[model samples]
Target chain A: MEPELATPFRERAGRALDDRFLQEALTVATTKFITLRREAFAELPEGDALRDQARAIKEATLQRLDYWLERLIERIESRGGHVHYATSADEARRVVLDIARRTGARMAVKSKSMATEEIHLNDALQAAGVTPVETDLGEYIIQLAHERPSHIIAPAIHKTKGQVAELFARELGRETEPDPEVLTRIARAELRQKFLDADLGISGANFAVAETGTVVLVTNEGNGRMVTSLPRVHVAVMGVEKVIPSMTDLAVFLAILAKSATGQKLSVYTSLVNGPRRGGEPEGPEELHLVLLDNGRVRQIAGPLREALNCLRCGACLNVCPVYRQIGGHAYGYTYPGPIGILLTAMLNGPAAVKDLAHASSLCGACMDACPVRIDIPKMLIELRREVDQQGIAPWPERAVFGAFAWLLQRPRLYRLSARLGRLLQRPFVRGGRIRWLPGLFGEWTRTRDLPAVARRTFHERWAALEREARR
Target chain B: MTTKAEFFDRIRAEMARTPGRAPSALAARPVRPREGLDVLRRELSERWRENLDRFQHELERVGGVLHRVAEAGEVPDVVAQIAAERGMHRVVTWPRDTLGVDVAAPLVTRGFDAAVMPGTEVAAAERARLRGLAAAADLGVTGAEVAIAETGTLVVVSGAGRPRSTSLLPACHVAVFERDVLVESLVQMGLVLEAWHEGAEPSWRGAAINFITGPSRTADIELTLTRGVHGPKEVHAVFVERGLSVARRA
Candidate 1:
C-alpha cells in the first residue's frame, strides 16, 4: 500500500511479469477495456471534436484559474459550502482531520478517491481516532488487504475471486464462496451498514463546475451518491486542475469520460451537488467542504510537464500502453501508474522522482490517442526525460554512455575509427549477426535484450566505395 | 496551509512566466441559456416520440427495464407487478404531490407496506426513522425530473419530497415519468442545467441532481460484471403516455 518503494522499478516490473495470475488478470482487464472504449468511440460521430474541445477547455481554464477559482469560492460560500485550500499533502491531510475533529466524526465512509490515496488520508484519519471505511467494492477489498489500488477504475483486478474470498473470510469473518456474485452480495450487505452509520463521507471530485458551484462525481457503483447524500458532512478533495468553467464544459467532459474509462455512455450515476442539504430536502448532507489541493500542479503551468495537467485519469491510456500491459500498475510504484502516470509522478513529485519512469513508455503514442483530453503524454515524457538528464538525476553510467555516443556522433573521423576498432573488439562477442552478451557494465543491457553486431564494413565505408566505383 | 490569496498568487506567478504557450479559448457557453433552452424545447417537441424511442432503446441496452402505460393510474399496477415478481412486500416512494400519482394508497390496498416521504422538513428522529424505512424497504418509487433519451439516463433532483436514497438504497428502483421530462441528448440536458442555475434556485431544490443511467454496477472482481454493489440492482422506468397533472418546467 505504501507503494512497495523498497524495490526498484525494474525488479518490481519483473515480479509482476513472473506472476502468472497478475499477467492473466492484467491482459484480460486491459484488453476488455480497450475493446469497450473503441466500440464506444466508434459509435459517437462527434467524439473527436469533443476531445479537442475538452483539451482546449482545460488549457484555457489553467490560463485564468485564479478568476475561476475565485468565482467558485464565491458561489460555494453563497450556497453555505466551505472551501479549503491546501498547498501540500500534509496540509490537505490536516485540513480534512480538522474538519473531522470539529464535526465530531467517528466513522468515515469513502468512495474511490485517488486524490485521497495520493495524500494518504486513511492513515491520518485512523491516527486521529476516526475509523475510515472504504465503501467502493474494489477499494474496500484492497483496503482490507492493506494494499493500494492496482488500477484506477478496477482496484481489485489483480485479485482473483478466490483471493478476495479468502481476504473477506479473514478480514470480515464472513465465510463466503469464491463466486463474484456471492462475494459482491456479501460486500453489499456489509458496506450498506457503513454507508448508513458513517458520520463523514469523503470523495474525490471528477470535475468541479465553477459557475454553478457544483461538484460532479461520476461513478458506476452508485457509492458517490450514497457518500454525498447519507453522511451528515461530506468532503470532496480535488486537484486544483479539475476545476472546469461551467455545466456546458462539464457536458463535453462527461460525453467522453465514461466512454474512455469503460465504454459506458454514462457511468451509472453522475451526482452534481451544489452544496449540502437545502431547506426542504428530505435527506442530504448538512455540511459540505471542498479541499482544493495544489500538491505540485501550480509549477507545471509553465513547466515542461504542463500537458499532463490535462489528464482525465480515465485509464484508457493504461489499457493501450504496451509497457503497462506487460508490467501492470503496481509495478510503476506510485499513486498513478501508466504512460500518463510517469508524467503525473513528475508533476507531483518532481522529475528526479521519475528518472527511470520517464523512460517507461515506448513512446508509441497510444496513450495520447486514448486520452479523452488528448494530453500528449509521450511529448511530456520526452520532456521529463530531458529534464531528468539536465538535472543530473540520471545515473552516472547512463550519462557517460550517452555522453560518449554524442561525442562520437559529432566527429565523423572519430566515429569511423571507433567503428573500425569495434570490429576488432567485438570479434569475441559477435555470433550469427548478433551480440548475445557483452562484457563488464555493458552486459546489463544485453541481459534482457540482444544488441545488433557492428557491421564488418560501416555504412560510410560502403557509401565511399560506391562513389569510387561510379567515378570509374 | 495555503491561504486563497497565496494560492492564486502562485498560479498568477506561473501564468506570468508563460505568456505565449498557446492561444486557446474555453468552450463557448450559451449566451442566453434560458432563451436557447426555450427554442430548443419547442423544436424537440415535434420529435418527442422519436426521442422516446431512442431513450427506450438506449435504456434497455444498458440493462434497464422500460414500461409504457396509457395513464398515470396504470403506474401503480406496473409497480405492483414488479413487486410481485420480486416477492417484495415493503415499498417507499415520494409523496403523492411530488410523484403526481397516489401510489401509497393503491399499494397498501394491494397489501404492500408503503411509506411516502414527507413534503416538509421533519425532526431528526423522524428523519432517521424514514431513512431506516427506506433502507429496509425492497422497492423505492420516485419521479424523474428529466430523462435523457440519448444515454438512457433518468435525472432525479433531490428536493422536498424527493429523497436521494429512494432511487439509491433499495434493491429495486422504479421511476415514473411523463413525456415532458424527456430530452434528446446530453447537450440538451446541459442547457436544462444552465437554465436551472440561471436564476435563483428553487427553494425546494436540494443539493444533488443525479443522472441514473442504469442499475449500479461494478467490474472490479477479475472484470466480472456485478450489479447493485451499493445501490439498486434493478431500475425500471414507467412512462405515462397520457401525462401527469404536475407542472412541467419549460
Candidate 2:
C-alpha cells in the first residue's frame, strides 16, 4: 500500500511555521529572486513592449492548441521521435517506465520540471529498480531528505543553512558547515557524477511547437541541457496544454516567463530540439520521446478552468501570493503549491479528497495581478470555496453560521436586524473595534493579526435615512 | 496479439475518432489573430533581449564563451578561424539565404561524405546524410533567420531548403547573423511573425526552429559549471554586415 502522499493543509502549515529557520530561509531566498526578477524586467529598456507580444503569443498559441498538437505529433513521429498521450499521473509513469524498461535503463538524471513533480516520476523509477537522480541543486537537497518541494521555484526555500548543514552532514555522509557557499559546494560535488553516470534523461517542456514538432527548455542552470543530451535515451514529460502552434509562439512566453520568474529577459539556456541527434554530433541522446499528460487538463481546457491552462509556470504568482507569503508552498500539501495549487488540486484530485486546500487562500488578488498571463486565480479560489461550501466540507461552526445567515438573507428585515446584532455581538472580542482574538472557528484568521471590525450601522439603514432627509 | 495488445488496439481504434488531416489541414481555419500580431512582436522583442541576457549569464556560469559581434559580412571568416583553431576542417555550414544557399567555394571543394547539396530540398534523408557528412566535417553552420540580441539567442526556422539538424547536430554550431536581423527584443519581432503565420496550414510540417542562446552547458553537478556535457559544447555566432533583402520578412 502507498503511504499517504498527503499533508493536510493544517498539518503542513503547523510544521512550516514551527521552523523559524525555514521561515527565514524562505524570506531571504524569495526576496532575492523577487528583487532580481523585478530588476531584470525593469532593465529590459524594451520590456513593456515585449510583455505585450509575449502575452499575445501565448494567448494565440493557446487558442489554437488542438490544431498545433496534431501537427506536432506527426512531425515528431516523422522525425523518429515517439510520443505517448497519458491521461493521468499513473499513465504518465507507465509510459515512461515502459520506455525505461525497453532501453534497459540503469540510471536516470532529471532537471526541475513541475509536471514531473506533479506526477512523482522519480518514485515510479525507484519502484522500477532504476536509480533516479535529481540534477537540480535545490531538488537534490529535497531528494536527499526524501521530502517534497516547499516552494515553486526554489524547492529548498523552507530549509535554512543550518538545517541544510545538518541534513548534508547526515545525508551526504560527511561533516559540513552551515555556510551558504559551503553547502552549495557540497551539493555541486555530488550532482556531477550523476549526470555522467545516468543512462536515461527525463525533462519537462517549457514550450512545445507544433509547426516544428520541437520542445523548448529554458533554464538558469544548464542541467536541463545535460539531462536531455548526455543520456542515450531522453524522454520529455509534458502536460497536453503545453503545445503551441508555431516556433513563433515561444516569443511571447519568452517575454513573460523571464520577467515573472527571475526578472530576466531570458534564461541562461533556451534549448529547442525537434528530435534525437541524427549524424556526427559528438553528444546528445540517440532517442527522444514525449509523454503528453492530460490527467485532468483536457477537461479544464474546455471548462471554466481553461484560464488555468494559460499559466506559463513563471512562479510570479507564488512570489506575490499573500497566503503563500504566510504559509509557503509545502503548506498546500501538493506538488503545485500556492494559489495555483489550491485550484489545481481541487480539480485534479477532486474537492472531496483535497478539501482542506480550498481554505488555504485569503482571496487576495495579488497572485492574479502578479500573473504575467493574467489568470484570474482569485475568482477560481472563490469558485472552489463555493464547492467546499456545497460539500459541507467547511468548519462546522462556519457552516452553521452560513446556514443561519442563508435563512436570514431570504428575509430582508431579518437580514438587516442580523447584521446589526452581529456587529454588536462581535464587539467584546474586538480591541479598538477590531477583533484581535476570535473565540472559536475563525482562530486561523486571528492567530497572527486582527480581523477587520464591522461598522455599527448597516448600509441599508443609512440609505433609508438619507431618503427621508432628502424629502424634508 | 495478447490481451494488452488487444486493449491498445481497441484504444487506437477509438482514438482514430477523427482522422487527422495533413499538417496543412488548418489552412481553411479562419485567420483570426486572437491577439494583435504586431502587438505580440513588440512585446517579444523586449522579451528576446531579456531572454538573451539571461541566456548569456547562464552560459557564463557554466564556463561557456559568449561573443557579441556587430556585423554579418565577417561571419565566414570568423567561423573559419574558430574551426581552424580547433583543428576542425575548413568546411562550414551556412543558414539559408533567401536568394540561394551560402556554401563558400572552398567548402564546396571539400570531398566530405555529403554536404547540404546547395539547391536541394532539406528532406529527412538529406538531413540524415548531412549529419553523417558533418560528423567529420570541420564545422556545422547555419544562418539565423532571427537573432534576439536581448537573450543573445539565434532563431533558425528550418524549412525546405534548410535542415534542422545542421544547426544542432554538429561538433560546433556556427550561426551567422546580419546586424539588421538582430532584433532588440522578441515583442518587436512578433509583428512580422503574425503575418508569417497568417495562412499557415495546420498540417504544414516544418523542421525544428531551434532558438539557441549560447553553447550547451550544465550546472547540474552541485552547481559546478561544466561545458559541453551534452549538445554542442561550443557555439560561435558571426554577425554578418549585410542583411538579405530578398528573404521574406515575417
Candidate 3:
C-alpha cells in the first residue's frame, strides 16, 4: 500500500527521518555512491576543469535553450520524425495517449527516464490500456514492488536485495534469490522477448542536438537503445531545455554527465539516433516522434531561476543532499528529487505549493560539491524560503511570532525585555543545564532531536564581565 | 507530404537563431581545431572511447561481452566464429571498402546470409528486410569510423558506405577497427566532432549518429539486466595486432 503523499514535504521528511532504517539506508547508499563517483572523477585529468567545462557547456546551452529547442523540433521532423510541442504535462500526456491509441499499442517498454516519470507515462499508458514495462533494473524492481523511485539514478536504492527477491517472486511468479546478479538475470530473461514483441518504444533524451536532429541517449543497460530501436514506432518525450545547438556540443555534456551521475566515464551505450533509418537500413523504428515538453521550464528559463535548467539529472546532488539522503525522492513529491527536486518542484508546482520543500534541506554545502554543473542549491533554497515568507503563506503562529519579533528586534529596550522574558520562560524547563523537553508548539522540534538550552548569560552580560576583568 | 527534408529545414532555421555556436572548453590549449578525415576520425574515436570504457565494464559485469581488436584482418574469422558458436548465420554490415566483401565471404561460404548497406537506405521495406535478415542471421557486423581505446567505444558515422541501421538494428554488432583510431580523452573527441561540422551543412548526409559500447541491454522490466532490449544484444571489437590504435599520454 502507498503511504500518504498529500502531506507537506516537511512532515514527510520528518516522518522519514523518524524511520531509522530509511535514514541509515539512504546514508549508506548515497555515501558509497558518492565515494565511487569521487574516485571516478579523481581518475580523470584535472577533474575540476572538466566540471567547469560541463558547467560552461550546459549554461551556454540553457542561455539559448529556446532557439535550440526550435531547431531540434525542426531537425527531428526533417528526418521523417514527427515533433510535437507540449505546453503542459496534460498536453504531453494527451499527445502520447493519442499516439498510443493510434498505434494500437497494448504494451510498451520504457527506460529509466525521469521526464517520462515526471509526466507519469506509466500511469497514463496503463489508463489507456497500454501496459508500461520498466526496463531499467532499479525502475523495474520499484515497479514490481509498486513503489516509486527513491533515488534519481538508482530508483530502488531504498530497497534491499532481499526485498527485491521477494518482490520478484511474488510479482514475476517465479522463485528467485536476492543475489544482485541473479536478480539481474531474472529480469533480463523476462524482458528480452518483450522488446521483440512491443509495438512502440518510449524514451527520454539526455541531450537533443539541434545541429544533427539527433537524440542522444546515454545508458548503462542496452535497454535505452532497444526501446528506441526495436519497436516499429519510437516516441521520445523530452523537456525543451534538453536541447544543444549541435552534435559538437554533445561531446561537452557527454564527458561530464556519466562521471557525475554514476562514476561512469560513459555509459556502456550512448546511442545518437537521428530520425529513423532510411532506404535499405534495418532494425530501427520505421517512424520516430519527438515530444518537446515545456511544462514549467520555459517560465523559469528567463528568470533568475534559469540556472535550474543547467541540471543534467546526474543525481550527484541527490547523493550528497542531506534531506534527500534522509527521506529519498518519493518524499519530494515531484519527479526530480534532492537539491534539484527542491528547486524544480518549487518552479513546477509553484512556491506556494511547495513551501515546505525548501525547509526540508539542512543547507549543508555537500550537494554543491557533488553538482557537476555547479547549481548553487543552498542559495536557491534560502531564496525560496524568503519567497515563501514574503508570500505570507507560513503558519499563523510562526508568522505572528516573526512579525512581533521583527518589531522587537528594531528596538534595543524591547529586545532586551524579550530576551529576559525568553530566559524566564525557559527557566522552568531547564534540567541539568540542558533543556531535555519542550512544550506545545516546540514539542515537534525535540521529539527525536535534542534542543539545546539558551546560553546562561547574554552577550551583554558576558561583555560586562569582560569589562570588569579589564578594570581589574 | 511533410518530407524529412522540410522538417529538417525548419530545424536548421531554428538552430540559426540559437546563441550561435558554443565556445570550446579547450580554449587554453591553443584553439587549433583540427578538421579533415584523420583529425575528425581521431576526435570521434577519442570521445567515443572515453565514454565507452567508462560504462562497458558494468555491461560486461551484468552479462555483455566487450573485446578490443588490434586489426581489421582478424575481423572476418572472429565474426564467423561468433556467429557459428552463437548459431548466427545471416550477417549485415555497413557497406565500406575497408570491411570488404572478402572479409564477409568466409561466413557466406559457410552458408550464412551476408550483405553490406549504407545507413541512409532505411525505409519500411528495408527495415522489414533487415529484421528478416536479423531473425535469420546470426550476426550483424559493421565497421566504426572511430574507435575509442580508453573505453573501447565504437563510433559509427553513417554515409555512402555505412548505414546507421546496420550498427543498431542487428542482434549483435561486430566492429573491425585499427589501433590508430583510439583517443585518450573526450576533450580531443569534442574537437573532432566540431571540425566534422566546421563548414558543411549541419545535417550533412548522415541522419543518425550512434555511439554503441556493448550489446542492447535494459534493467527496467523488473530491475534486471536484460540484453537486446532495443538494439544488438552483443557488441564485439576486432583490433589488428599491427594496426592503428593510439593510447593517451599523461
Candidate 4:
C-alpha cells in the first residue's frame, strides 16, 4: 500500500530530512551506488555505444508498440500460455484476481516487481482473501513491516539490521541477533516453504521479447526462479513499453543494466521464461500468463514524457539525484521516486499530482548522465513544469510570483525601475549580504537556505557602464 | 476486462498521433544467426584458454569458485573433494546423458546418496517426490549450456534430464562444462540465443533459461551484501580441458 499522499511534498521531504537514520542510510547507499557505477562504466569500453543502441531500441519499439504487442500476444498464446490486457490499474487487479480465484490459489509468492507496486497489487490480493508474499528480501522486510518500499532495488535500505531483527522477532516469532547474515538465513528458511507451498507465482517483466515470447526477470536472489518454477500458475505483469524487438536487443540492454544499477557485470540471476513448462520437463508451472498493463503509459506515447517510457527502472537516476539523496524515496510520496519518479508520478497520476514534485529538481542534469539510456530527464521536467503552470494547477502564489517576474522581464524600462525599487525593497531584509528571511510566499525559499541579495549593480547596468567607459 | 483488440487499438491511436518521433532502428539482429554462431564458436574455440583465464578472474571476482580438470572423467573426483570439504553427503544431479558425465554411480560407490534426475517425463506425483529430493539435497551438480566469459556467467537451459532445481535449491551448486560451451561476450550469447530460437524448438526444451552469474546474493539489509539468501551459498564451475562426449545443443 502507498503511504499518505495528503502530506505535501515539502512537508514530506522535511520530515525525511529530520530522520537521522534515514539521512545516514541515504548518504551511504547513494554514495556507494554512485562510486560502483562509475567504476563499472570505466572498465567497459563499448558502454557508450551500447547505451545509445539501447535507447534507440526503446524508441523503435515504442514507434511500433502495437505491432510488437500483437506479436508478443500471438507468440505467448501459441506457446500454450495466456495473455491478459489491462487498460487500467483496476482492470489489471481484476485480471490477476480472476486468475487466482480460478486457479484456487490461496497464497501467491512474488519476485520484486515495480509494476505490481505501481498497481498496488498487494492490498488488492489481501482484500481478495489471497495472501501475497513478497519473496525479495528487501520487499519481504517492508511487507512484514507494513510499509512501502523506500528504494527501487534496495527496498529495505532505510531499515537497519536492528529493525529487521526486531521485525522478525515480532512477526516471524524468531528472536535473532542483529546480523544480516543470520537474518538472511532465517528469511531463507521461512520463505523457502512459501515458495514450495504457494499455488500462484507473480512477477514483473524486466524485458519481454516480442520476437520470442520470452519474459525476462533479473534478480539477485533466486526467488524469481523459485516463484516461476514451483507454482502451478505463473503471472507476469509488465508495462506495455517493456517489450523489445528480439534477443539481440535484450543483450544490448543487459550489457549495461547491471553496471548502471549495482555495478555488477550482471545480476546474480537472469531468468528467461518462454511460457509454461514444455513436455518432459520435470519442474515448472503448468500455466503461464503475461498481463500487459497500460495504466497511463499509452497517453505518454505521444505525450511530453514519451522518452521516459525508455526507463529500465534501474534506479541509477535516484542515486545521482541530489534531492533524492537528501530526502530519500518516501518523501516523494509515490511508488516511484527520484527525478525519474517525478516524471513517472506525473505520467501515472496526472500533471496536477506532480505540481510540487516537478520543482523538486535543480535541473543539474546528473540524472541525465547517470541514466542508462541517457533520457533527457531535466528537459522533460521543464516541459512538465510548463504544463503544470499552463494547466493552472500550480499554486496561485507561485504563479503570481513567476508570472509577475515574467511580465516585468519583458519591459526594459519596468525591469530597470523595479531593479532600482527592488534594492530599496530588499534593504530591510538584506543583512550581511544575504536575505536570511522573507515575508509571505517568498519566505518558504529562505526557511532553509539563505538567498543572496540582489547584486549591487545588475548585469545589465554593469554592461551599460562598461559601454559608457569605452566611449569615454 | 479490457480485450486485446481494444488494448492494441488504444496503443495504435497514441502511436498514430506521435508522427514526429525521431526515426530510429532497433539493434541489428544477426541475418543468419545459426551461421554466425557457428563461425563465432570456431573463433572462440581457438582462444578458449584466454577466455577461460578471463572467466576464472571474473568468476572469482564475483565470489564464485572455479576448478580446472584435465579430462571429463576427473570431474567426479573434484565434486567429491568439494563435498568432502563441506561435509556434505546428499547430492542431486542432472542425468548422465544431459551432463555428459556419470557422477551418480561414482558418488554411490564412494558411499554418497546421489540422486540422478530422470531423462524422461514422470508422473506428477513422482515429480513432486523428485522435487522433495532436490530440496533436501546438500549439493547440486549440473552441466552448463553456455559459459559466458565476459561476465563469468553460466547459462543453463532446463529440459527433460536437466531440472532447474538441481542448480538452484541446494546450498552449493557445481556446474561442469567443457571449452565448447565458452562464449567471449554477451554479444556472442545473443547470437547463440537467436540461433536457439531460429525455427521450431525441440520437444525437450523446457520453459525457463537461467543465467547464474554467482552465488545468490542480496545487499538489501542496510546495504550489507549477504550470500545465499534464497539459492546456493556457493557456486563452483569446473572447467574440463578435454571436452565432454555428450551431444551439445546448438
Return the TM-score for each candidate structure: 0.98, 0.73, 0.83, 0.99
| lDDT tens digits by residue: candidate 3, B113-231 | 78755334455666566555554455677666565544546677654445555666566778765545555545556555655545543332444556666666544332345566546
The whole-model C-alpha lDDT of candidate 1 against the native structure comes to: 0.91
State each model's CA lDDT, in order: 0.91, 0.65, 0.70, 0.93
Ranking by DockQ: 4, 1, 3, 2
* Candidate 1 stretches greater than 4 Å from native: A1-3, A462-472, B247-250
By the lDDT metric, which is better: model 3 or model 4? 4
What lDDT tens digits, residue by residue, belong to model 2 across residues A363-407?
878787777766789888778778778988787876888788789
Per-prediction fnat: 0.87, 0.13, 0.33, 0.87
Give the CA lDDT, 0 to 100, for residue A432 in model 3. 72
Residue-wise C-alpha lDDT for candidate 2, range B1-250, written one tens digit per residue: 1233342343344334423321211111224553555454456555654545554555454334545554344444565567667877635354344322344643444432225433344444554455456444546777666666556666766543455445544557776655445555565454435445555422222423455666554432222344443346577655443443325432
**Per-residue error (Å), model 4, residue A216:** 0.4
Error of 4 at A12 (Å): 1.1
- Candidate 3 falls in which docking quality class? acceptable
- In DockQ, how does model 3 score against the reference complex? 0.27
Report the lDDT of model 3 for residue A202: 93
Residue range B1-250, candidate 4, lDDT tens digits: 8988888888888988995877578988999998898899899989999999999998999899999999888989999999999999999998888888898999999989999999899999999999999999999999999999999999999989999999999999999999999999998899999999998888888989999999999999988999999999999999988857665364
Residue-by-residue lDDT tens digits, candidate 1, B1-250 = 7888898899899988865666467777888888998888788888889999999999998889999999999989999999999999999999888888889999999999999999888888898999999999999999998999999999998888888899999999999998878899997898889888998877778889999998999988888899988989999999999846553332
For model 4, the docking class works out as: high
The candidates' DockQ values read 0.83, 0.12, 0.27, 0.88
